[model samples]
Target: MSIQLRPTRPADIPFVYETEHAAENRPFLLPWTEERHRQALAHPDIRHLIVEETETGRAVGYVIIAGLTNPHGSIELMRITISAKGKGYGRQVLRQVKRWAFEEQQAHRLWLDVKEANQRALNLYLSEGFVIEGKLRECLKTGERYESLLILSMLSSEYRD
Candidate 1:
Protein backbone atom coordinates (compact mmCIF):
# COMPACT_ATOMS: atom_id res chain seq x y z
CA MET A 1 0.00 0.00 0.00
CA SER A 2 3.04 2.26 -0.16
CA ILE A 3 3.23 2.56 -3.95
CA GLN A 4 4.40 5.73 -5.69
CA LEU A 5 2.52 7.65 -8.32
CA ARG A 6 4.58 9.06 -11.15
CA PRO A 7 3.50 11.08 -14.14
CA THR A 8 2.74 8.75 -17.02
CA ARG A 9 4.78 9.12 -20.20
CA PRO A 10 3.96 8.07 -23.74
CA ALA A 11 5.81 4.80 -23.28
CA ASP A 12 3.51 3.92 -20.41
CA ILE A 13 0.44 3.75 -22.61
CA PRO A 14 1.03 0.19 -23.70
CA PHE A 15 1.07 -1.04 -20.12
CA VAL A 16 -1.91 1.06 -19.26
CA TYR A 17 -3.82 -0.26 -22.25
CA GLU A 18 -2.82 -3.82 -21.55
CA THR A 19 -3.76 -3.47 -17.92
CA GLU A 20 -7.13 -2.08 -18.88
CA HIS A 21 -7.76 -4.98 -21.15
CA ALA A 22 -6.45 -7.56 -18.73
CA ALA A 23 -8.92 -10.36 -17.96
CA GLU A 24 -8.86 -9.51 -14.28
CA ASN A 25 -9.92 -5.92 -14.89
CA ARG A 26 -12.00 -6.14 -18.06
CA PRO A 27 -15.27 -7.02 -16.36
CA PHE A 28 -15.13 -4.15 -13.89
CA LEU A 29 -14.38 -1.17 -16.09
CA LEU A 30 -14.42 -0.06 -19.67
CA PRO A 31 -11.20 -0.46 -21.63
CA TRP A 32 -9.67 2.40 -23.55
CA THR A 33 -7.44 2.25 -26.59
CA GLU A 34 -3.80 3.33 -26.73
CA GLU A 35 -4.78 6.39 -28.76
CA ARG A 36 -7.40 7.30 -26.18
CA HIS A 37 -4.85 7.01 -23.42
CA ARG A 38 -2.47 9.19 -25.42
CA GLN A 39 -5.17 11.79 -25.89
CA ALA A 40 -5.92 11.74 -22.17
CA LEU A 41 -2.26 12.36 -21.41
CA ALA A 42 -2.49 15.65 -23.27
CA HIS A 43 -5.78 16.68 -21.72
CA PRO A 44 -5.42 19.54 -19.26
CA ASP A 45 -8.24 18.38 -17.04
CA ILE A 46 -6.89 14.87 -16.75
CA ARG A 47 -4.07 13.34 -14.74
CA HIS A 48 -2.67 10.09 -16.10
CA LEU A 49 -0.40 8.44 -13.56
CA ILE A 50 1.50 5.22 -13.16
CA VAL A 51 1.48 3.47 -9.82
CA GLU A 52 4.81 1.94 -8.97
CA GLU A 53 6.40 0.04 -6.14
CA THR A 54 8.20 2.41 -3.80
CA GLU A 55 11.40 0.40 -3.40
CA THR A 56 11.54 -1.50 -6.67
CA GLY A 57 10.23 1.18 -9.04
CA ARG A 58 8.21 -1.48 -10.83
CA ALA A 59 4.93 -0.30 -12.26
CA VAL A 60 1.99 -2.26 -10.95
CA GLY A 61 -0.91 -0.16 -12.13
CA TYR A 62 -2.30 3.18 -13.31
CA VAL A 63 -4.87 5.77 -12.22
CA ILE A 64 -6.78 8.41 -14.12
CA ILE A 65 -8.35 11.48 -12.49
CA ALA A 66 -10.38 14.10 -14.28
CA GLY A 67 -12.26 17.39 -13.77
CA LEU A 68 -9.30 19.43 -12.60
CA THR A 69 -11.01 22.50 -14.03
CA ASN A 70 -14.31 21.95 -12.27
CA PRO A 71 -15.32 25.26 -10.70
CA HIS A 72 -17.45 23.38 -8.19
CA GLY A 73 -14.39 21.60 -6.84
CA SER A 74 -15.82 18.17 -7.65
CA ILE A 75 -13.40 15.66 -9.14
CA GLU A 76 -13.89 12.31 -10.78
CA LEU A 77 -11.94 9.19 -9.92
CA MET A 78 -12.08 8.15 -13.54
CA ARG A 79 -10.28 4.84 -13.40
CA ILE A 80 -7.95 2.56 -11.46
CA THR A 81 -6.49 -0.63 -12.89
CA ILE A 82 -4.00 -2.77 -11.00
CA SER A 83 -2.52 -5.66 -12.93
CA ALA A 84 -2.48 -7.95 -9.95
CA LYS A 85 -5.34 -8.33 -7.55
CA GLY A 86 -5.46 -9.12 -3.78
CA LYS A 87 -2.08 -7.47 -3.21
CA GLY A 88 -3.35 -4.41 -1.27
CA TYR A 89 -2.02 -2.15 -4.05
CA GLY A 90 -5.54 -1.02 -4.88
CA ARG A 91 -6.13 0.23 -1.36
CA GLN A 92 -2.76 1.94 -1.32
CA VAL A 93 -3.57 3.62 -4.59
CA LEU A 94 -7.00 4.65 -3.35
CA ARG A 95 -5.56 6.25 -0.23
CA GLN A 96 -2.99 8.10 -2.31
CA VAL A 97 -5.67 9.27 -4.72
CA LYS A 98 -7.81 10.56 -1.83
CA ARG A 99 -4.93 12.65 -0.56
CA TRP A 100 -4.21 14.01 -4.02
CA ALA A 101 -7.82 14.86 -4.72
CA PHE A 102 -8.69 16.43 -1.39
CA GLU A 103 -5.42 17.89 -0.12
CA GLU A 104 -3.41 18.55 -3.25
CA GLN A 105 -6.20 19.36 -5.70
CA GLN A 106 -8.41 20.96 -3.04
CA ALA A 107 -11.38 19.10 -4.35
CA HIS A 108 -14.56 19.27 -2.30
CA ARG A 109 -15.74 15.90 -3.52
CA LEU A 110 -14.18 12.92 -5.23
CA TRP A 111 -16.35 10.30 -6.83
CA LEU A 112 -16.20 7.14 -8.92
CA ASP A 113 -18.54 4.64 -10.52
CA VAL A 114 -17.87 0.94 -10.27
CA LYS A 115 -19.56 -2.01 -11.87
CA GLU A 116 -22.17 -3.48 -9.51
CA ALA A 117 -20.55 -6.88 -9.70
CA ASN A 118 -17.14 -5.56 -8.65
CA GLN A 119 -17.66 -6.44 -5.02
CA ARG A 120 -13.96 -6.25 -4.26
CA ALA A 121 -13.65 -2.67 -5.41
CA LEU A 122 -17.00 -1.68 -3.93
CA ASN A 123 -15.99 -3.12 -0.59
CA LEU A 124 -12.67 -1.30 -0.80
CA TYR A 125 -14.31 2.01 -1.60
CA LEU A 126 -16.85 1.74 1.17
CA SER A 127 -14.23 0.70 3.68
CA GLU A 128 -12.05 3.63 2.62
CA GLY A 129 -14.82 6.11 3.49
CA PHE A 130 -16.58 6.62 0.18
CA VAL A 131 -20.36 6.70 0.58
CA ILE A 132 -22.79 5.16 -1.82
CA GLU A 133 -24.71 7.83 -3.69
CA GLY A 134 -26.88 5.88 -6.12
CA LYS A 135 -26.92 3.22 -8.77
CA LEU A 136 -26.95 3.57 -12.55
CA ARG A 137 -29.06 0.66 -13.64
CA GLU A 138 -27.61 -0.97 -16.74
CA CYS A 139 -25.66 2.04 -17.87
CA LEU A 140 -23.11 0.31 -20.05
CA LYS A 141 -23.05 -2.52 -22.55
CA THR A 142 -19.57 -4.00 -22.58
CA GLY A 143 -20.47 -6.73 -25.04
CA GLU A 144 -23.75 -8.57 -25.44
CA ARG A 145 -24.42 -7.99 -21.76
CA TYR A 146 -25.40 -4.80 -19.98
CA GLU A 147 -23.83 -3.76 -16.73
CA SER A 148 -24.96 -1.52 -13.92
CA LEU A 149 -22.74 0.70 -11.80
CA LEU A 150 -22.88 1.99 -8.26
CA ILE A 151 -21.83 5.58 -7.70
CA LEU A 152 -19.81 6.36 -4.60
CA SER A 153 -18.19 9.51 -3.27
CA MET A 154 -16.41 11.18 -0.39
CA LEU A 155 -16.56 14.79 0.63
CA SER A 156 -13.40 16.67 1.58
CA SER A 157 -14.91 17.43 4.97
CA GLU A 158 -15.21 13.71 5.56
CA TYR A 159 -11.61 12.91 4.66
CA ARG A 160 -9.37 11.20 7.17
CA ASP A 161 -5.58 10.70 7.10
Candidate 2:
Protein backbone atom coordinates (compact mmCIF):
# COMPACT_ATOMS: atom_id res chain seq x y z
CA MET A 1 0.00 0.00 0.00
CA SER A 2 1.16 3.50 -0.85
CA ILE A 3 1.53 6.07 1.94
CA GLN A 4 1.79 9.82 2.19
CA LEU A 5 3.29 11.72 5.12
CA ARG A 6 1.70 14.94 6.26
CA PRO A 7 2.35 17.38 9.06
CA THR A 8 0.57 15.98 12.05
CA ARG A 9 -2.58 17.60 13.37
CA PRO A 10 -3.48 18.06 17.02
CA ALA A 11 -6.14 15.40 16.69
CA ASP A 12 -3.56 12.84 15.68
CA ILE A 13 -1.79 12.88 19.05
CA PRO A 14 -4.03 10.18 20.51
CA PHE A 15 -3.38 7.93 17.56
CA VAL A 16 0.33 8.56 17.84
CA TYR A 17 0.27 7.84 21.53
CA GLU A 18 -1.77 4.70 21.08
CA THR A 19 0.43 3.35 18.33
CA GLU A 20 3.72 4.00 20.11
CA HIS A 21 2.63 2.51 23.38
CA ALA A 22 0.83 -0.44 21.87
CA ALA A 23 2.08 -3.81 23.02
CA GLU A 24 3.51 -4.68 19.63
CA ASN A 25 5.64 -1.53 19.46
CA ARG A 26 6.28 -0.54 23.07
CA PRO A 27 9.28 -2.71 23.81
CA PHE A 28 11.26 -1.66 20.76
CA LEU A 29 10.82 2.07 21.37
CA LEU A 30 10.94 4.55 24.18
CA PRO A 31 7.39 5.75 24.59
CA TRP A 32 6.76 9.45 24.66
CA THR A 33 4.09 11.06 26.75
CA GLU A 34 1.13 12.78 25.13
CA GLU A 35 2.41 16.18 26.23
CA ARG A 36 5.83 15.47 24.78
CA HIS A 37 4.30 14.66 21.44
CA ARG A 38 2.29 17.84 21.69
CA GLN A 39 5.41 19.84 22.44
CA ALA A 40 7.14 18.42 19.37
CA LEU A 41 4.57 20.00 17.07
CA ALA A 42 5.78 23.42 18.06
CA HIS A 43 9.50 22.70 18.39
CA PRO A 44 11.28 24.73 15.75
CA ASP A 45 13.78 22.02 14.80
CA ILE A 46 11.46 19.06 14.94
CA ARG A 47 9.09 17.55 12.41
CA HIS A 48 6.34 15.39 13.82
CA LEU A 49 4.50 13.75 10.96
CA ILE A 50 1.69 11.31 10.43
CA VAL A 51 1.85 8.50 7.90
CA GLU A 52 -1.44 7.97 6.13
CA GLU A 53 -2.47 5.53 3.48
CA THR A 54 -2.85 7.35 0.18
CA GLU A 55 -5.95 5.41 -0.77
CA THR A 56 -7.80 5.66 2.55
CA GLY A 57 -6.27 8.73 4.24
CA ARG A 58 -6.09 6.94 7.57
CA ALA A 59 -3.19 7.40 9.96
CA VAL A 60 -1.26 4.15 10.29
CA GLY A 61 1.91 5.48 11.88
CA TYR A 62 4.01 8.52 12.79
CA VAL A 63 7.61 9.72 12.42
CA ILE A 64 9.58 12.18 14.54
CA ILE A 65 12.51 13.92 12.88
CA ALA A 66 14.80 16.45 14.53
CA GLY A 67 17.42 19.06 13.56
CA LEU A 68 15.56 20.56 10.64
CA THR A 69 17.82 23.63 10.64
CA ASN A 70 21.00 22.35 12.15
CA PRO A 71 24.10 24.38 11.52
CA HIS A 72 25.96 21.17 10.75
CA GLY A 73 23.37 20.09 8.18
CA SER A 74 22.72 16.84 10.00
CA ILE A 75 19.23 15.58 10.79
CA GLU A 76 18.13 12.81 13.07
CA LEU A 77 15.36 10.35 12.45
CA MET A 78 14.19 10.39 16.02
CA ARG A 79 11.48 7.80 15.74
CA ILE A 80 9.26 5.94 13.29
CA THR A 81 6.51 3.54 14.22
CA ILE A 82 4.26 1.94 11.66
CA SER A 83 1.24 0.25 13.18
CA ALA A 84 0.17 -1.19 9.88
CA LYS A 85 2.88 -3.69 9.06
CA GLY A 86 3.43 -6.37 6.39
CA LYS A 87 2.47 -3.91 3.62
CA GLY A 88 5.86 -2.28 2.92
CA TYR A 89 4.70 0.98 4.44
CA GLY A 90 7.85 1.40 6.51
CA ARG A 91 10.14 1.30 3.49
CA GLN A 92 8.00 3.71 1.54
CA VAL A 93 7.93 6.27 4.36
CA LEU A 94 11.67 5.93 4.92
CA ARG A 95 12.38 6.54 1.24
CA GLN A 96 10.21 9.62 1.33
CA VAL A 97 12.06 10.87 4.41
CA LYS A 98 15.41 10.34 2.73
CA ARG A 99 14.30 12.33 -0.30
CA TRP A 100 12.94 15.13 1.80
CA ALA A 101 16.06 15.32 3.96
CA PHE A 102 18.57 15.22 1.14
CA GLU A 103 16.79 16.74 -1.86
CA GLU A 104 14.50 19.25 -0.26
CA GLN A 105 16.18 20.10 3.03
CA GLN A 106 19.73 19.78 1.70
CA ALA A 107 20.79 17.82 4.72
CA HIS A 108 24.36 16.57 4.53
CA ARG A 109 23.62 13.61 6.80
CA LEU A 110 20.60 11.72 8.05
CA TRP A 111 20.94 9.41 11.01
CA LEU A 112 19.06 7.31 13.54
CA ASP A 113 19.60 4.88 16.39
CA VAL A 114 17.83 1.58 16.69
CA LYS A 115 17.71 -0.87 19.55
CA GLU A 116 19.86 -3.90 18.88
CA ALA A 117 16.97 -6.31 19.30
CA ASN A 118 15.04 -4.58 16.53
CA GLN A 119 16.62 -6.63 13.77
CA ARG A 120 13.78 -5.90 11.41
CA ALA A 121 14.37 -2.16 11.47
CA LEU A 122 18.13 -2.58 11.35
CA ASN A 123 17.92 -4.69 8.18
CA LEU A 124 15.73 -2.12 6.49
CA TYR A 125 18.14 0.74 7.33
CA LEU A 126 21.13 -1.26 6.08
CA SER A 127 19.36 -2.19 2.86
CA GLU A 128 18.46 1.45 2.31
CA GLY A 129 22.17 2.38 2.52
CA PHE A 130 22.64 3.61 6.10
CA VAL A 131 26.04 2.62 7.41
CA ILE A 132 26.38 1.45 10.97
CA GLU A 133 28.38 4.16 12.71
CA GLY A 134 28.70 2.75 16.24
CA LYS A 135 26.90 1.13 19.08
CA LEU A 136 25.95 2.68 22.41
CA ARG A 137 26.40 -0.46 24.40
CA GLU A 138 24.14 -1.02 27.39
CA CYS A 139 22.95 2.54 27.25
CA LEU A 140 19.26 2.39 27.92
CA LYS A 141 18.21 0.86 31.16
CA THR A 142 14.92 -0.97 30.97
CA GLY A 143 13.20 -2.37 34.03
CA GLU A 144 15.91 -4.86 34.88
CA ARG A 145 18.63 -4.90 32.21
CA TYR A 146 20.26 -2.43 29.88
CA GLU A 147 19.74 -2.28 26.12
CA SER A 148 22.13 -1.20 23.42
CA LEU A 149 21.34 0.99 20.42
CA LEU A 150 23.17 0.89 17.13
CA ILE A 151 23.68 4.22 15.45
CA LEU A 152 23.41 4.35 11.68
CA SER A 153 23.62 7.05 9.09
CA MET A 154 23.57 7.88 5.36
CA LEU A 155 25.25 10.78 3.70
CA SER A 156 23.75 12.95 0.95
CA SER A 157 26.11 11.49 -1.65
CA GLU A 158 25.01 8.00 -0.70
CA TYR A 159 21.33 8.54 -1.23
CA ARG A 160 20.02 6.78 -4.34
CA ASP A 161 17.04 9.03 -4.94
Q: Which candidate tops lDDT? A: 2
Query: What TM-score quantifies how close candidate 2 is to the native fold?
Result: 0.98
Off by over 4 Å in 1: none
Error of 2 at 153 (Å): 0.2
Q: Give the whole-model CA lDDT for all candidates, comma-separated.
A: 0.92, 0.95
**Can you tell me which runs of candidate 2 are displaced by over 4 Å?**
none
For model 2, name the residue pairs that clash. none
lDDT of 2: 0.95
TM-score of each: 0.96, 0.98
lDDT of 1 at 114: 93
> Model 2 over residues 28-147: C-alpha lDDT tens digits?
999999999999999999999999999999999999999997999999999989999878999999999999999999999999999999999999999999999999999999999999
Q: What are the candidates' C-alpha RMSDs?
A: 1.3, 0.9
For model 2 the local lDDT of residue 121 reads 96
